[model samples]
Target chain A: MKKILNSADTFVRDTMEGIEAAYGDRVGLLDGDFRVLVSRYPAPEGKVGIVTAGGSGHLPLFLGYVGQGMLDGCAVGEVFASPAAEKMADMIRACDRGAGVLCLYGNYNGDVFNFRMACEDVEFDDIETRQLLGRDDVASSPKDRADKRRGVAGLVYAFKIAGAAAERMMTLDEVTAVTARALDNIRTMGVALSPCIVPKVGQPTFTIEEGQIEIGMGIHGEAGIEVRPMMTADEIARLILETIEADMPLNAGDEVSVMINGLGGTPLEEQLIVYRSVHARLAERGVAVVMPHVGEFATSMEMAGLSVSVFKLDAELKELLRAPAATPFYTNANK
Target chain B: MKKILNSADTFVRDTMEGIEAAYGDRVGLLDGDFRVLVSRYPAPEGKVGIVTAGGSGHLPLFLGYVGQGMLDGCAVGEVFASPAAEKMADMIRACDRGAGVLCLYGNYNGDVFNFRMACEDVEFDDIETRQLLGRDDVASSPKDRADKRRGVAGLVYAFKIAGAAAERMMTLDEVTAVTARALDNIRTMGVALSPCIVPKVGQPTFTIEEGQIEIGMGIHGEAGIEVRPMMTADEIARLILETIEADMPLNAGDEVSVMINGLGGTPLEEQLIVYRSVHARLAERGVAVVMPHVGEFATSMEMAGLSVSVFKLDAELKELLRAPAATPFYTNANK
Candidate 1:
């Protein structure tokens, strides 16, 4: 593999060690447990604690989001493998203050199952917690089975909005309610130009014909929902937006935040190019984009693709999304 | 080439369109001249106007820094090709606010020649202007010939320090003095794992064996000063830090801001892994790291490698580096 790493066995641990070394003032491991990361600045007592956990490889997602005005703690897993339930329980306990903790994570079989077990364990300790699943990717399932869909880049909006709500000292139930609302309003779809090699696998996850593009491919390179000849940036933007609008029914005067998230290998230049078409298409439909995020907010390790997430916002959601966020990997001006 | 673009001829234009569409609030083109990007909130009458220009393909480099507290304007060129002197002159005239303008750009042959001509053209218009070149690539030249060295990732520090000075309403001479001090204290080196395909070229810039790497490779795949078998991330970090220290002489009590910038295709996970070693080595030497930036701050489109920039700072540079700055691609919390 043409990757800059020491060994496949220690890829995840090495990454965590590096993360702590770089952002020690803002984030650190929980009691020297490298798998559990918590913010260095703890929230006030009675403030709801937000926690997210998932497999590694997706930086700025489960792990990079833990800091001031964002997630309180994150239980990190190995590459594409869920963390242990005990680790998740430990993270929850660390982030828990007088207010209850919220288990906010992506909706995946491994993650959901482990988090369910974690909540059960934490329940025995009498730490109140609420579970909120991020189900925003429209390609994994039909709208009728939305709850079964997998989460992708849209998970960023969940962390952002929910973290902002918790930072504002909302109750656990209130934070969960708003986060669920965000999940319900968010939709994300990805187009993969190339496959990525997992550290452990040491080979391409999948192969496709050269110059072909796969729409709605999972981050892990699972079979795409639609594979076709490579389309122009405008065409790709249209296909993704139409699919989302059909499911969410965005209309004139609708205000939303748009994120063009590079998976891993794509450059910010291309993400902005895609965002141009996305913004133009939305402008044509009279939909206003408030906060435009274009970069690698979430990524699969060295995967060449980009995902677009549209989170339709109301007044309250808009305010929360605009609230200042200061994480090691992300920071906002609070404008 | 496997790129999400409309046409190769319009690659730069397409990127500009996308950037302006997404960040119109923070940056825009001058009049109908798309090559000249100026900040939306122009500098006040007496504030020094900071303008940077260079060939494209480096996101957040010459273009992304044009905004409040960073750059007043930038004249953009094609991918790896310098912009015309007329466009540079136009950018200078547009940013001039009675108080002089400072032209801050990299030290490249085509750019130096072009900016020299640009200043001459503006001199006739009676618009006061001064020029400062960023030269920090230790690999490009020896300390005895540092003036001939090429500028690379260390250019980011120049912009950050210079932009902060201009925003504080420093005079042209004052801004020039502080920026020159920053340039003298900076050093950079890069290691390339793979090459990137220029959109118009439709081919990789260069190639290497499957398990080989090139140290000190330029962003456009220029011949490296050193090539060897692939090394672990720790080894790579040591090689780079050793080279930079040889040139800059970092001391035990020195305080520096480190930037491990990914060249498009390197994932943040690997970047952090490298940072882990970089931080450990610095700590061992008793050199303090402040405001570490680890990401794709500057990139070659889809190039799989990274560059390390260490800018030793004093009290003044440290405050300026930490000052609040907001651009489309960057922002600081003003902490």
Candidate 2:
């Protein structure tokens, strides 16, 4: 594979080393388990600790959120592979400050099974915990089966809101409630124009003819809903917005936050254009946008395309999203 | 070409629309001139205002730096084409306060010609202005011929340091002096693995054989120092670090900042891996890295590769680098 790495076998470890080297003041690996990354400064006494974990290849996703106003720790896995249950348990135990912990992550089968094992593994710690999975990808499943949906860019909202609640000294039950509410308000859809190769696989995860697009593709190159000829930026933005609205309808006078996340290879300019369209469409619907994010919040390792996420908001959600946060890849100081 | 644009004709303006839509609260298009973007909250009275201009396609370049505590205004151009002198004059006039304005941008032929014309055009306005060019690419020219070097990722440093000097209310001459010092102490180099397709051009800027790399290539696909087979991330990092050291030696006990900038399509995971290597190599020589950045700061559109920039800093320079600055795409809340 034409990837800039020393070796495929050590890809994840090498990436983690670089991340720790660059952001040591902010985050580092847990002492007992190298796969678990914890914030340098733990939460205050009696404050619930927020933790997350997921596969690799998506920067700013699993570990990039660990910091002052965000996640407390995270368990990292190999590229697109789930981490072990013991690592998750180690993260939970380390982050527990006698205020319990929250196991937040995506809705992948591998991740779901491991998180279950992790909760049982930490039962003796006497620290109550809650499991909240981000199931915001509306295109993955119908409205009646939202639990089966794959979490995508909207997972970022879950991290921000949940972390803000915990940082504000919310109890474990309160933090879980707000996180679940935030997750329920999020709806996301994506379009992919090209495939990305896994360094170890040395091949494209999937293929499409040049000048075509895949609708509703999973981050790990799972089959999208359909393959069709490429559409203009505005067309793609409108289609994604329409689909999201169909599922989580944003009516007149409603307010929300919008995110146009790039799937790695897309340029920031293009993502902004997509954001412009999304905002314009929302404005036409009389919906106000509070804190909008347009960049590569989550990516599929150089895959070409973008995802649009809208989080319907209330006063509390707005304040939580705007809470001061400082992480290596993300910083929202507009408190 | 596979791009998410509405049309190649309106690429620049459409992108500008998106940018203004997203960051309208922080920046807006200059009245009576759509090509010039000025900060919403201009610099305080009597503070030196900073303005920069260059061709488009490089997001977070000229326009992305225009906001609070950064550039006061910027003139936007068509993709890879220099903006007209009158537009630059408009930006200069809009940003100029009672004190003066600083014209800091890359040392490009068209940009140099236009900035000169722009200053002369606004001379009748009776507002004093100073010109500073960024020339940090060591691959384009040797140290003795540094003036002939092309600006690349190091231009971001110029914007940040110079903007910080201006924001802190330094005198026009003083800001110019510190900016010149920062430019003198900086060095940058890059390698492009594949070509980027310009929107209107409808073709690759330059072509390379598969799995090959163009060492020291320019952002606009300009020919590099040489072409060779792709090397491992560690080898590439060492080669670049050694080359930079050969020209500007970094001895023991040296303190500086490092940046591993992705060229557009490269994954963040890969960039972090490269950062890991660069940091390890620097540490081997007893150099201390502060405020290391690993992401897409300045980029060529959809190009596959990355650039490394090192800013050798003194006490004052380090403080300025750590100063708080916030733009739409770049935010340094760390002070």
Candidate 3:
């Protein structure tokens, strides 16, 4: 393996230690569990607490979003592995501010099982928490089975709207409602040119032959809908948009927020290329892009791929999306 | 040759088109020169124009900084090549708003030569401008010959400070003076686990044997002072700090801003690991870390390595460093 790491055995702990050291002023470890990272800026009393938890390989996903206008805490698991239920419960306890907590995460089986258990554990403590699953990957399921789809880069939108709602002191139910609405409007699909290596594995989670690409691969190297010879950026953008539009059915005059996310090894220059095609396709259909984000938002370890996410916006959702946010990996001008 | 690109000849233009398409609201191309990207938000009538430019491949460097509280314009070049003098002059013209422009970039020979020519060209139009060369790579030169050092991640510091100075309506000379101060206080060093592939070349610029690393390597695969067996993150961090301290002589109670920049392919998890060591080393020396940034700031086209930059700060520099800034790849809370 050509990775620059100390050892597979200590990878997770070392990384967490590093995270805490680097962001000491903004974040802190849970009192008893280091895996549960909490924001140092305490949430306002009576404000809903926002928490997300999942595997660790995707930086700025679960932990990187914990800040003033985003997540309150996150339970980090091993790379591509779900965190334990106990750890998730600890994260909930750390962030609960008496107004109740909202648990949000991707719809992976292991993540669902563990977060559900954590919700139950938190309920036992009378924390009064709610849950919302992100199933935004249109290629993972048919339109009728949207709830079965996996979450991809669209999770960042959920974090933004829901966190803004919570920051505005919305009730837990209101926060959950806004979060679900964000998820409903979001649709994401990805194309992978190469695979990512989990540190512990010391090898690629999966492989792709040279000059070939996999459409709709999950972040953890999950099976995609199809594999084909590599195509131009324009062609790939069309394929991803068509798949998402078929499921969500965007229309003329529709206003939407777009994200072109790089899956680790892909450079920002190429991500912009993909975004160019996406913008052109959307404009051709008379769909107006209100807010556009182009960069590595969610990623596999070092996978060379890109994902496109479209979040159809309403007045309420647009306001929440434009709200100010500050995090290590993401920040927006309130204007 | 495992790249997701269309053609080498059209790569730079295609990427620039994509950038304009994605960020049309905040940025736009110069009227007569597509290679020059200028901010859509107009600068104040007498505000100094902050401009940066260099070769392509380093996304979020030249073009990404062209937004509020940052760069006013950027001239772009082909992959790993200096932009033409004519293009640089066009960028200067687009950003000049009565107040003079400040031209800042790394101390590269080609860039130096071309930018000098561009300066002469812009002078014909009676635009007052100043130049500040960044030379922060300590490994590139001895302490007595610091001007010979190559600029790496430290260039980002120069951008942040000078951009803030310009935004605060500092005079052209004032912005240039602060930028030069920032460059003097900064030092950087990097290690490369592997080389980057130039898209046009379709091959790695250089190679490293498995289980080995090159310390103090340049961003463009330039030769380093030494190659050695890969070591643990702690050992590597110690070596880097020792070398930087030997050259710059960091002292106790010194306030510094630290940036752990991923060259390209290094994941955020690993970058955090490196940051952890950097924080600990500074703390051990009783040096105060004022602002810490860890991520892919200035990249080298998906190169599998990272660079460490430390900028010692004074009261005046600290205020500018903490000033509000919004860019595609970076944002500050402005607290």
TM-score of chain A of each: 0.98, 0.98, 0.97
Off by over 4 Å in 1: none
User: CA lDDT of B239 in candidate 2?
Assistant: 84
| Between candidates 2 and 3, the DockQ winner | 2
Interface RMSD of 2: 1.7
Over the stretch A1-335, how does candidate 1's per-residue lDDT look in tens digits? 88998898989999999988988888899998889999988689888999989999988777988888889999978899899999999999998997999888888888899999999999988999999888888988998998889988888888888889998889889999999999999999999998888889999968867889998998878676988999888899999999998899999999999999999988777887899999999999999999888888889878888999999999999999999888888876722
- Which RMSD does model 3 reach against the true structure? 1.6
TM-score of 2: 0.98
Compose the digit string of candidate 1's lDDT tens values, residues B87-143: 999999989888888898888989999999999999999988888898887888788
Higher TM-score: candidate 1 or 3?
1
**In candidate 1 chain A, what residue range of length 10 has the lowest lDDT sum?**
A326-335
Return the clash pairs for model 2, or none. none
lDDT of 3 by residue, A1-335 (tens): 76766788877777888877877678878874668888887677898999998998888677888887888999988898899999999888878889899998899999899998998998888999898988999888888877788988899999999989998999999999989988989999999988888887787767899889998898989989999998988899999999888888999999999998888898888888888888999999999998798888888978889899999999999999999888766776622
- In model 1 chain B, the worst 10-residue window by lDDT is B326-335
Give the DockQ-based CAPRI class for model 1. medium
- Candidate 2 stretches with Cα past 4 Å from truth are none
